[model samples]
Target: MSDSDKAFFTRASELIELANKQNQNKEVKTGEISASFMYAVARYNAWFGSTSFETKEQMQTHKQEMMEYYVERYKEMLEANMNDYIEHFDHYRKTQK
Candidate 1:
């Protein structure tokens, strides 16, 4: 992988590691954890996008485009991951050390 891609994956892996730690607490269901994760991503993305534009009008104009972009990217990622899991169900299901 290119250095940029490696760095991107490294950051993503760190977040996943943090989420896995949170999952170790049995009181929190996986669905709840994932929902919270998605909420944080949405919240952060909104705030991050807002910082780029100086006016509410400009942000409003681009909001739909921004939402569409994120939704499409998410759908693609989810499908890819789902396929990967389905293809490697046995390996993925096995407990990792």
Candidate 2:
């Protein structure tokens, strides 16, 4: 992996750690929200780095298109993951109850 890839992974790991900490503290909602945001941002950055384009103008256009795509996809992923996370937390709560 490139340096950028390593950096992305490091950041993503840190975010996951933060989420785990939140969950351990019984802050399920906050943890999920934070994780979703961090995941979206990290995913976007990773995708942006992976794309290739020649010429400044082409790169700029691609970036714009990618930004839009990432925004929509990230939102969807965030919602789905957040729902899953919340559901998992609820299950834990029920077990404890």
Candidate 3:
């Protein structure tokens, strides 16, 4: 991984650890959100790094385009995951009751 990727991973890891910290008043949800954001940034950075660009402007444009394409896909994935989790939660609740 590149230095930029490493930085992103570090930030993401920090968020994950922060989420687990007992001292957090807002708690796990806050950390999870931050961690997710960091993960996306890291993914974006990695994506940008994977491509070749001759100019700074070209690289910037490419990054923007990639983000535009992937952000929607990421949202869809998250929604689907949330739906599955909700379904599982409902089942688990029923079983517990």
Candidate 4:
């Protein structure tokens, strides 16, 4: 991981925490930001990490491969999270009603 990757993720975490606080204050629950936040983190780690490539074409190729792998994992994790959230919400609603 590069400095940019660490810095971006740390900053993103802080911003998301602030956004959550704002949501709490507003009495809102969107349940839509976590996966997006993680996807950005994955993208930054894949694109911003230090890499030594001999040529422009090499760098481009590497980036494309990295994005492919990262994006696939992101999609899988996002779907899993969504499913977990749906199950949890269903349970909560059942108990509440």
Candidate 5:
């Protein structure tokens, strides 16, 4: 991975660790936690994109374009992570103990 990739993963790892901590609370369902995380991300992305544009009209005009960009990027990352987990299932399970 390039330095940028390393930095990205480092930040991602920190967020995942926070989520894992929440998972440790037996009362919390993983699906609910995942949904909340996704919602928060979507909200933040909308805010970030809004700030990038000078006007609400401009932001509204590019809303679909921005959403598509994020969705595609998320799909790519999700697929990559799913494949990685599938490939290292045993190793991850061992470490989880």
Candidate 6:
């Protein structure tokens, strides 16, 4: 792999770690935001790493297709995380109220 690829992987791993830490905390909103941002960053990295198109138009088309696939996968993972967060928060809130 290239240095750029290694750098991107390192950054992505750090972001994933941050998201994991957030997942262990009490704040659902914070965790959701962190996870969402991580997903976006990973998707961006994948696009950067995978594209072979040289022209602007071709790059845009490739990016769009990749982004669509990313979004679909991200949505499923995000939904699961959000649901778990919501359930935990709701249970905690009930104890407080």
State the RMSD for candidate 1. Answer: 1.3
Q: Residues 1-97, candidate 1, lDDT per residue (tens digit)?
A: 9999999999989989988999999999989989999999999899998998999999999999999988998999999999999998889889553
TM values, all candidates: 0.94, 0.45, 0.46, 0.49, 0.90, 0.42
Q: How do the residues 1-97 of candidate 2 rate in per-residue lDDT, one tens digit apiece?
A: 9999999889879977866676676646775777687777778685665567556677766776777777798799779878887979978678756
* Order of models, best TM-score first: 1, 5, 4, 3, 2, 6
Q: Which stretches of candidate 1 lie over 4 Å from their true place?
A: none
Candidate no. 4 TM-score: 0.49
Clashing pairs in 4: none
Question: Compared with the true structure, what per-residue lDDT tens digits does model 3 show for residues 1-97?
Answer: 9999999889867865755563366654765666776787778676666577777778777777767767787799679878887979978668756
Which TM-score value belongs to model 1?
0.94
What lDDT would each prediction earn against the true structure?
Answer: 0.93, 0.74, 0.72, 0.71, 0.95, 0.76
Pick the winner on TM-score between candidates 4 and 6.
4
Cα displacement (angstroms), candidate 3, residue 63, comes to: 3.1
Q: After superposing candidate 6, which stretches have Cα over 4 Å from the reference?
A: 1-43, 46-50, 90-97
Preferred candidate (lDDT higher): 4 or 6: 6
Tell me which residue pairs clash in candidate 5: none
Go through the candidates in order and give the clash count of each. 0, 0, 0, 0, 0, 0
Alpha-carbon lDDT of model 2: 0.74
lDDT of 1 at 45: 91
The candidate, 2 or 3, that scores higher on lDDT is 2
For candidate 3, give the lDDT of residue 29. 72
Over 4 Å off, model 3:
1-50, 91-97
Worst 10 residues of 6 by lDDT: 45-54
Task: Give the winner by TM-score.
Answer: 1
Model 5 TM-score?
Answer: 0.90
RMSD of each: 1.3, 7.3, 7.9, 7.3, 1.3, 8.4
For candidate 5, write residues 1-97 as lDDT tens digits: 8999999989999999999999999999999899989999999999999999899999999999999999999999999999999999999989988
- Alpha carbon RMSD to native, model 6: 8.4
